[model samples]
Target: MTEALLDEAGLVRWGRSLGEVAAREAVFVALSGPLGAGKTRLTQAACAGAGVSEAVTSPTYTLVHWYTGGRGPVAHADLYRIRDASELPGLGWEELETRPGAVFVEWAERAGDELPPDRWEIRFEFAAGGALRRVRVCVRGCAPPIPDPAVYSAAPEAPSC
Candidate 1:
């Protein structure tokens, strides 16, 4: 599905809807975008929607960060600094997938074939002079269904951390 994010709140609402669907089972989300494209913000909102209270920030330096206040553990990974997929093992990529929770990867293209086949791919692009953004979301292999936009539009009633 593709959607327009008019503001940060809209992006958060969309992420929340996605988080709701992800809470049902282990899932992988690959985020692709240029610098300052709101990837971390979306992940933060998703974690919040999943009931995680801990602060969610980009794992650009640490590579991976885990949150557990939600239905289950939520793993966030940033591969911007990764030089090769071979470094994934050293970062415990396999173990993260085996956990019962959702995984969100930033700069996922860098992961290459290391990423699971069943994953949700989200691509973001600047629009309207960076005042808005266009998000394209798609699923690969056997992934969970994405929630309808209506679910996100009704942001007032969205689940909270």
Candidate 2:
């Protein structure tokens, strides 16, 4: 596991770097955080890094959204509205798991034990008086390593989270 304190721009760069590497192979990323923690923003940056030309929006209500990028396919799902893990299958959870390229799920803890064992988990916490985010990344099974946002130099300020 690794952790870093990142401003909004740093968070985006870190997410983009993660996407660049993850795009090389199929991977599942689970994002867990409270509201306004920047889960969707990170996903958008990652999709951009993967060469997704279209806008990447949160599937909070839609549940799931799919797009084809230069690297391959990208699937973004939000489980915020899900009341139980048992409800996932109705949303095509099985099919989403088998998707190629990268799959990102927000409010992923809502899935409980139903999530794949081999995956990456990222958690975000408000920090520095909510001016920054404390991000933690961990791997399960044979999941690939994640980039350390601390390695990136300070980036210009971005819109507040």
**TM-score for each model:** 0.87, 0.91
Alpha-carbon RMSD, each predicted model: 5.5, 4.9
Best by TM-score: 2
lDDT of 1 by residue, 49-140 (tens): 77889888888888889888457678899988887798888786786677778998999998898889998999888877886667778889
- List where candidate 1 sits over 4 angstroms from the true fold: 1-5, 149-161
Off by over 4 Å in 2: 153-161
The 0-to-1 C-alpha lDDT of every candidate, in the order given, reads 0.80, 0.85
- Worst 10-residue stretch by lDDT in candidate 2? 150-159
Residue 138 lDDT, candidate 2, scale 0-100: 92
Clashes of 1: 0
lDDT of 2 by residue, 1-161 (tens): 87788888888988888777666666789999999999999999989888889999889888889878788778899999997798888786777776676888999999999888989899999988887988888989888877776665343347699
How many angstroms is residue 127 displaced in model 2 relative to the true structure, after the best TM-score fit? Answer: 0.4
